[model samples]
Target: MAKLDVELKVNGEDYKLQVGSQERLLDTIREQLKLTGTKEGCSVGECGACTVIVDDQAVNSCMVLTAQVDGSKIITVEGLESKSGLHPLQKAFIEKQAVQCGFCTPGMLMSALALLNTNPEPSKEEIKTALEGNLCRCTGYQQIIDAVEMAAEEWGG
Candidate 1:
């Protein structure tokens, strides 16, 4: 297989990488970029544990080929924080105690961020729709929903 050179802007940083045709975006984000926040639960797209924001849309990183995203902008769970402090969603997640086993938090955050980026004032149903692909075995999703609501209240302005 020939390695294709691709450029990606991830977490506000630019990276030029040579990726294999078979490499998934999740593997590139995790192995090449060294951003471990994006977790791979199921190699298939059933579990949203591998979700990430690509070009401001929530997508299953495992389902996308790295070469398919050349020149794309991506935001992972690592991208949620800043030098000043945690992103509003991150703080809300912590405050709401929406995390357990910690495997699904990153994908959930990215999905919520995608929704919030477009619709800052998403209703409960909207939030649920954005996160329907993600599956969390703990917290029963109420806290996660609450976290997004809390963040919307803060960051929605």
Candidate 2:
């Protein structure tokens, strides 16, 4: 396969990489850019474990080809923290014990981040809808929803 030249802005950093045309976005982010924060659950896109924010929308990385997202801005779980402190959602997740096994965390965080970015004060139903694509075998969704609610409060949503 021929390698294609591409540039992606991820987590506020720009990267120029040579990617194959058949490369999935998940593999490109994880293997090429070394953003291991994006997990790979079901490559078929049913699990939502490879979720990332592309231009403020939560999308399954496995569902997109790296070539399809040229020049796009992406945000993975690694981007959630800053020098000041952990993001409000991260704090809430830790306090509420919403993470388990840790495989689903990155995707969950990305989905939640997208939700908050769009609707800071999302109702329970909205939260549920936002995370419907993400599957977490551990940590029942109640705690996750609670954590999102708490973050909304902290972020003044």
Candidate 3:
């Protein structure tokens, strides 16, 4: 297989490398960049555990080929935090106790981030819509919803 050269800006860092045709963006982010916060749940894209922000939109990393997003900007769960402190959403999640089992939190966060980025003040229904793709077996979704609301209120865009 021929390795295709790709460029990506991830979490404020730039990267240029050669990727195999079969390499998915999820593997490139995890294995090549060593950002493991993006989890692989269902490879078929049913589970949103591998969600990430590609060019400011939330997408299932498992479904995207590395070569498909060669020049895109990507943000994973690890990109949410900074040297100052946790992102408002992360703080809200902790305060609302939205994390349970911790399997889907990364995807949930990415989805929520994308929503918040576009809609600073999203209605509960909108929040639900944004998160519908992400499946969380724990927390009953109420806490997660509450966390998103809280983050929106606190961040105020």
Candidate 4:
């Protein structure tokens, strides 16, 4: 099989990579770029564990081909932190104790980040709708919703 060249700006960094034709964006981000914060739970996109921001939209990395998103900007869970510190969403998650078992936190954060980036002050229903794609077995989702609400407050203020 031939490889396809792709250019992606991920987590504020640019990368030029040659990837397999069948390679998923999740694999490229995890293997080539070494960004493991994006998890692969259900490869068919049913589970949002591999959620990431691509071109300002929240998408399941497992569902996208690296070649499909050539020249796009992407943000994974690792991108949430900066020189200043953890993002407000991250801090809110911790403060609200939204993490448990830790498997779904990355996807949750990414989804929430995508929402907050666009909405900044989403209502509870909007937050629920934004996060509906993501699944969490722990924390009961109430905390996650609360965390998103808290982040929205902090983000708006």
TM-score of each candidate structure, all chains considered together: 0.97, 0.97, 0.97, 0.97
Clashes of each: 0, 0, 0, 0
Q: Which residue pairs clash within candidate 4?
A: none
lDDT scores in order: 0.94, 0.92, 0.95, 0.93
1-157 per-residue lDDT for model 1 (tens digits): 5699999999889999999989999999999988999999988998799999999999999999999999999999998889999999999999998987889999999999999999989999999999999999875699999999999999995
Whole-model lDDT, candidate 2?
Answer: 0.92
- Local accuracy of candidate 4 as per-residue lDDT tens digits, 5-119: 8999999999999999999999999999888889999889887999999999999999989999999999999999999998999999999999988889999999999999889
The lDDT ranking, best first, is 3, 1, 4, 2
Measured with C-alpha atoms, the lDDT of residue 155 in candidate 3 is 96
The global Cα lDDT (0 to 1) of model 1 is: 0.94
Regions more than 4 Å wrong, model 4: none
CA shift at 139, candidate 2, in angstroms? 4.6
Can you tell me which runs of candidate 3 are displaced by over 4 Å? none
Better of 3 and 4 by lDDT: 3
Relative to the true structure, candidate 3 reaches a TM of 0.97
Give the least accurate 10-residue stretch of model 1, judged by summed lDDT. Answer: 133-142
